[model samples]
Target: MNLQYKTIVVTGGGSGMGRELVIALLKKGAKVAAIDINKDSLEETVRIAGDYGINASTFVLDITDKSAVEETVKEMLVRLKSIDGLINNAGIIQPFAAVNDLDDKTTERVMNVNFWGTYYLTKTILPHLLTRPEAHIVNVSSMGGFIPFPTQTIYGASKAAVKILTEGLYAELKNTAVNVTVVHPGAIMTNITQNSGLGGPKVDNNDKNNMALSPSKAAQIIIRAMEKNKFRATVGKDAWFLDKLYRLAPKFATNFIGKMMKKSLAQH
Candidate 1:
């Protein structure tokens, strides 16, 4: 699962952890096809990837756009000549509003990008990836995926679905050349929360997890997981411990998370 000299396709690679991954992969001499809706951010990613002679390039396409996803990946395969791995990082987090408050557009937008987008790209690339002797699919699920947070129930549900989807892929691909890995990221400093409207009173933020690792650090963890072909990797101590607690007592864990969310949502 070495990333060096391999071709990797990363969704949402224009910013945050996805962008960090593109930088790291390029450093390892991998030819990366970075995808994002923001062409400007994607260009910024390439500028930082100067180590690879700027070999990394961006594809401006919305992951939730099915036709665009298919066409984009096809073009990537044509240009790179191979698909070694895919990191599904493109996602949207709407306002931290209750389900009743959440509008149809927001709900559908989140589901379409976070869940369906992952599915569309995975399905389109699985066959091509399977053709390679050793390929990987890294699905970026979240700590939220493991433990439900108030106002984020639907978002969590979408991520949780991604977790199961990854597991299913692993189950069916057993003994096959391809590897499926699920990543649960801890609280990290990224534009995702702020840009996607996850902050403010809409969602809780009282207990700011400052032990929060940066996207670059998280990217390193993910790269390590790929090196070991880890079936699952939890990004920080917080996310790991919380995941265990979740398995032990989902009922209690749910209540605890609710409190945390409430705290974060404290008067700002």
Candidate 2:
């Protein structure tokens, strides 16, 4: 579907790829309702939009709250007039630890923010999207969602749930006006570690050799996938490569990634 003049609602619009998605949508002449948990970060996103800021609206919302999501969707529709797209981009990672070593609170927080949050927003806004002539829903699932990452087991599970949820939505909405696409992004340069309330990862995220994709580039790939109505899209070369490898040899790919990650962690 053409994004021009369309109204899209993006969660996690406060920063990272979410902010870039909002800006990119504005550049494409689409109106954006940028939702984030942080008011200051949302303001920064609008400020960066500069001239295109006029087409963007910011809503401070914690998507984990079902009631809050319901009310926020109503307000967005009232303000934006109609919703043409929804991007479930907000997500959080779990602390770097094995599932056995992790606490219940941390596990629940990751699940709530990464899975249930997406579910609530999609459930509330899908009805409105179905009413439109053409609509789209894009859910961000990580490469970790498809393959296990040693220390990020629970985080991977949450994203894996998102992957299936998005795919299920795609199957159910095949004949409908709404288009669904699930995204698997590899390592990207973002503040997700800090945002997840962790000091940092054991591996060096700042290293130039990490080959992490920029948020803007990731956003562009996502928008293109939506325009083409793709079923799934991988944001970076790493993600794309792994997707193919995993399909060709699931166990080998999993063991390969597990060993690589373990070595990387050990080095740090």
Candidate 3:
């Protein structure tokens, strides 16, 4: 579907790819309702948008709260007039530890933010989207969703749930006006570590060979996928490569990823 003049709602719009997605959509002649838990960050996003900021609306919302999500969606529709798209991009990672070592609170927080948050927003907004002549829904699922990371097991599970949820939506909405796309992003240069209240990953951001994809680039890829009505898309080389490898040889791919994670953890 064409994004021009469309109104799209993006969660996690305070920063990272979600912020970039908002900016990109505005530049493409679409209106955006940017939602985040941080008012300051949302303001920064609006400020960065400059003149295009007028086409963007900000909502400080905790998507994990079902009631909050319901009210926020209603407000967004009132502000934006109508909703043409929804991007479930908000999520949080668990602390770097095995599932057995992690506390219940941390696990629940990750699941709540990553899975339930997406579910609530989708459930509430889908009815509105169905009423539109044409609409789209994009869910951001991590590459870790499909490939297990030793220290991020719970995080991976939550994202895997998102992956499946989006896929199911796509299948169910096949004959409908709403289009669904699931995105699997590899490592990206974002402040998710700080946002999740954890230290940065051990990887060097300056290393050209290992550098993560820029948020802007990832956003562009996602928008393109939505325009084409793709069932799924990967945002980085690592995600793309592993997705193919895993399909070709699940055991070999899993073992390979396990060894890589083990080595990376050992380095720190």
Candidate 4:
């Protein structure tokens, strides 16, 4: 869990939080294998990690392709020598629309990347992780995973599945050497919408000041969580507040969130 001298695999490491995590892990002296579909962004990540010397490498692969994932992880292990951790940060958002208005293909893609993608990698790497003395697994769920959000229902559902899956893994690994941590991040400034192939809204001028967290900060928090072997961590104020609110008053929390998202929902 110290991360130092350990080897970790991070999905979606081309940019955003995933890239930040690669940088952070390298700083901690961990060997990293950064995976993403974008070779250019992955190259950029490795460039930034140059100061860390040969402790980092990049892999270009689609997580949703189970066969590709299996093959890639096998090759990744050869490059990294050994794997001590797996962070599933690769995911996509659904088009902004209600479930009734959403297309089947989009729905499937969302679930495939967000949920099954995580599953595929986890399944492939778990046995190797078990062989290690200690290892960590970090899964990025979202505030929307536990809190309902208009126009993001399918995206939320996919993340929700991840939330439960991580929790279940934690339970199963209670007495094992591997540790599991689920993360719920809120309003981190990232190009997720653009990467997901959905044009995002122009940033509200107010949003520049009001956003809850940054990818670097989130990466720091996640690394801390891994070091501490925490069961769960919420990355931003909004995520923490919503998590508490939903647990205390699900109906009221849903209504409140719906009200806040009314404008965006209308556009959808």
Q: Tell me each candidate's TM-score.
A: 0.94, 0.96, 0.96, 0.95
Residues 95-138 of candidate 4: C-alpha lDDT, one tens digit per residue: 77889999899999999999999999999999999999999999
For model 2, how does the per-residue alpha-carbon lDDT over 2-113 read when each residue is reduced to its tens digit?
9999999999999898999999999999999999999999999999999999999999999999999999998987887999999999999987788999999999999999
lDDT of each candidate versus the true structure: 0.86, 0.94, 0.93, 0.91
Clashes of each: 5, 0, 0, 0
Prediction 3 global C-alpha lDDT:
0.93
Per-residue lDDT, model 2, residue 119, is 99
Q: Please give the TM-score that candidate 4 achieves against the real structure.
A: 0.95
Candidate 4 at residue 262, lDDT? 90
Which stretches of candidate 1 lie above 4 Å from their native place?
A: 197-209
Candidate 3 lDDT score at position 26: 92
Off by over 4 Å in 4: 201-207, 265-268
Task: Single out the weakest 10-residue window by summed lDDT for candidate 2.
Answer: 199-208
lDDT of 3 by residue, 178-207 (tens): 999999999898889888878775434567
Which candidate has the top score in lDDT? Answer: 2
Residue 224 alpha-carbon offset, candidate 1, angstroms:
0.8
When sorted by lDDT, best at the front, the candidate numbers are: 2, 3, 4, 1
Task: Write model 1 residue lDDT over 29-78, tens digit each, in one string.
Answer: 88889998889988888887776736786799988888998999889878
Candidate no. 3 TM-score: 0.96
